[model samples]
Target: MNENENISVLFKIVVVLIIVGAIFGTFMSIVNFALIRSISNEISTLNNLTISSMNDRMNRMDSDISSLESNIQPGGIVDEYINAYNFLSNTNLDLEKLLTFASETPDATYLTVYIAGRSNVWITVTNNGQSLLQADLKPGLSDYVFFISGNPNVKTSYTIMLAPSSIITTSDASATYILLAQNGKTSILHTKSPSLSVSNILK
Candidate 1:
């Protein structure tokens, strides 16, 4: 062939080789990028699954711990404490019922009086103008016993007088009276009784 034609053919071959190299490099880059993205997605999915499994395990562990705590035996401290409290409460109720029964019986020889006050006071109990008991009472609650002279089954009248210890005059003192029977019936004598004068009748 001629020298110029040979040079032209060599130039065309070089150009074609360059174009093929460029296309191959671009395709390889695209393939590498797709592989990297797919690998990253798989890694993220694996991490999510691991986290979910760990959370499920933790939840199960918590539930097991709660169940163990709830399975306390009857001889445990918590159970014993509850049992003792119930026993004490029941015993107190039984004692109260017994006292009430005794107080309502016809053979009972004494009457009980409960006093509640806001301040210190002097109390006097009288039956038919005869003084039965005289004492000093402090604030809060107090119980007193007075013997009955007559037949307990019959109706009886009694008087209670309360005077503040800080006061000297009897005019400011308050008085309450009642008629009670052994059958556990009572009637208040005064209309303007003190608010703290609460009584329970036994049956």
Candidate 2:
């Protein structure tokens, strides 16, 4: 072949190579753009799901807070006045029964008396018209004593009793008393009193 013909063949080969290179570059650019768009879409979807989950959690928390607030309000599940009344009535009944039993029992000895939150009360024991013991009690305090009958060889009859003291009208308070007999018998008493107004309101 002549030199011009060879030169023309070389030019055609160079042009074909340039066209192939441009086509390949365009295809790669398109693929890259498609991949970037898919990734962006996925990221947006993930962000939306995360925000929705956070909002749901916030709404649940708000509901829980509201329920708690309602439970603690006045006339809710817990009533302070009613609780006080029940406490006082139950305590007074217990105390009355304990006093009556102690007074009527034969050979009774005042072993111990507990007054809840009252330091000014005390007890006195008398047998055959003679004073046996005088004990001082503190508020919210418990104390005990051992008693022996007048005759060690015989079971002596005695009287055990408490002095006239003011009753407790407060709520959420209680007292306990314990009595021990020479023959190893035991009696326990408890008294609780609630606030008068609170009790009255419930009724």
Candidate 3:
């Protein structure tokens, strides 16, 4: 072929390459724009979710604070202590012994124990193997009271056993054990043992 023909062919080739490159560039730009928009939307959605989570946590915190405020009682602990003190003061007994006996009862805050011998009986009250009251109680109303820690967490248990007079002693003696809780709840137990003298007399 002649030089002019070759030159025309070369010009056509260059023009076609330019058109292809322009089309490719446009497609790439469109793809890049779409990717950027998708990335921006995802970021925006993540940000909104984070904000919503933060707001929910803040609301929960506010609710907790409100609950705490509502439950706060003024001088509640002081009132418990005062009640215990008044109960103890009324007994007019050895405060130390009464307090010790109260300390021995288990799962209790405060207690008022009343034990009546109903006869000339030996009264032995022990707490954790330690003697609290070991005396002879006569018939009629027995004046036994106690005051423990007003705090419910403080706890102990006691054992009260009774024996008859020297003339009528027995291995197992009749006993009356009473447990009074701080809330004025009473639980009385009349033990039936080798002798029913105490229960019969008290009844």
Candidate 4:
């Protein structure tokens, strides 16, 4: 081949290689972007589904607790517990309600509300064959002590006493609050409250 033809051929080949490289680069960038977008979308959808499912489960559980609370004997600190539960289940952050419910600026009180676990014992009362439902610590006639302690489930068994200004709190939220309490025996110890309440409670 002539020198001119050879030079022209080399130039054309170089140009073609540059164009091919650009096309390949553009294709790889588009593929990478699509993969990233797909992964991000999948993650977002999964997160949304999980959150929505959790909220639904919480709502159902709140309904069950409300049903059980409705069976309470009208006037008890149980109403206060229901209030605390309402504060817990709501999504629209009621700062005022939560602060008020958890407020302990004045002092602590007696009567603690705990999560509904084995603490409840369903009972059936019959008066002249008329059935009345009552719940307690046991299926038998045992007092359901609603006392406040650092821990809701204090291993020590104590009967409910009408104590004035006994420390109280509630498990209104998931987070546990640390508490320091003294039982007047020159012993200093700390406990935690689920939520805050007044200091006076009648057993």
Candidate 5:
């Protein structure tokens, strides 16, 4: 072959190689960008799903709280309150032993619950009746449980509050509460329509 023809052929080959490299790089860039966008979209969808679940849980809890309030007695049934909490939190919280010690704290915030005239009493079982939380608790009265430890979120840090004046108008100026002790933990239970006594149980 003539030297001039050979040189021209070589030049054409180099140009073709450069074009191929550019095409390959453009294809890879497009693929990478698409993959990144897909990942971002997936994250957004997951976040939305998470938010929706949280909202549903909150709504359920609110409804349960309302139902319990409607059943509060003038006095209050302690065990019933605990049952309501367990129903809402889905935690097996015991308030029995805690009830035995409830009298230890008197006149404390959320520490003292009150209902009126035996209105707070409820039946836990067929004939086993007990006060809800306190006497002198007005009908439709709303009670708020404030976080005292500033860490109701930390499993080991959530400290429950007690309301004093619980069951006011009692002869001793002392109130009674139904303590629930579950899994070695004690708490006050509330109820909407708690059975007044074990005897009140429906067989």
Candidate 6:
């Protein structure tokens, strides 16, 4: 009878040890799951913050590009710069033309005349018996003619002649005035015939 009682006690102790091991395994599993979940949450939050920072940087870059485009639009700094460059180029061209004309006559006693016409015409300037100048004058085009008499004290006479260009037909000959300037005096001479004369213009 005693032997049977001891066998029963040993069986009961084994059952209790098995139950405790199962409970400890369950508790360890819960702890491990909680740790894993907390780590995953932290990583997700970091990714979101990184994405937000990148979006802010991209937004700032886009704003800067838009502002730059507006600044380069019409009537802006870029437009004004182009206008100034063109103006300076034209001014330089005009100055070069004036310098070329001034080099032709250096003496103070020489008579200088500028001839301009509204229509295409052929021009000639003569003093005494010598030919002084000849050129073709067109609309917006002019020529500087210079002549010097042997004696500056004596007044000089110049015979000016104007004729239609070869491109002009008789029917196409319209009324136009040729401008002549000398010694601060400007004469608007009418083109009526092929020949004209001016005697009173003096240096």
Total clashing pairs for each candidate: 0, 5, 4, 7, 76, 0
lDDT of 1 by residue, 25-89 (tens): 99999999999999999999999999999999999999988766765553455644654454344
Report the C-alpha lDDT of model 4 over 86-136, residue by residue, as the tens digit: 435431443343233333222322232223222332322223334322333
Cα error of candidate 2 at position 187, Å: 28
The CA lDDT at 196 in model 1 is 24
Write down the TM-score of every candidate.
0.36, 0.40, 0.39, 0.33, 0.34, 0.37
Per-residue lDDT tens digits of candidate 2, residues 169-199?
A: 3222343333433233445434333322211
Q: Pick by lDDT: which candidate is best?
A: 3
**lDDT of all predictions:** 0.47, 0.49, 0.49, 0.42, 0.40, 0.48
lDDT of 6: 0.48
Which regions of candidate 1 deviate over 4 angstroms? 72-203
The positional error of residue 14 in candidate 2, measured at the CA in angstroms, is 2.2
Angstrom error of the Cα, residue 17, model 5: value is 2.1
lDDT of 5: 0.40
Q: After superposition, how far is residue 67 of candidate 2 from its true place, in Å?
A: 2.0
In model 6, state the lDDT of residue 61. 91
| lDDT tens per residue, model 6, 1-203 | 69889999988898888888889889888998998898999999999999999999999999988887876875556655654454344435455544544443234223333222234545655545455555565433244433332223223343223221111111112222334443433444433444444443231
The candidate 1 region of ten consecutive residues with least summed lDDT is: 163-172
Residue 1 accuracy (lDDT) in model 5: 98
Task: Give the candidate number with the greatest TM-score.
Answer: 2
Assess candidate 2 and give its lDDT.
0.49
Q: What are the runs in model 2 whose C-alpha is more than 4 Å off? A: 73-203
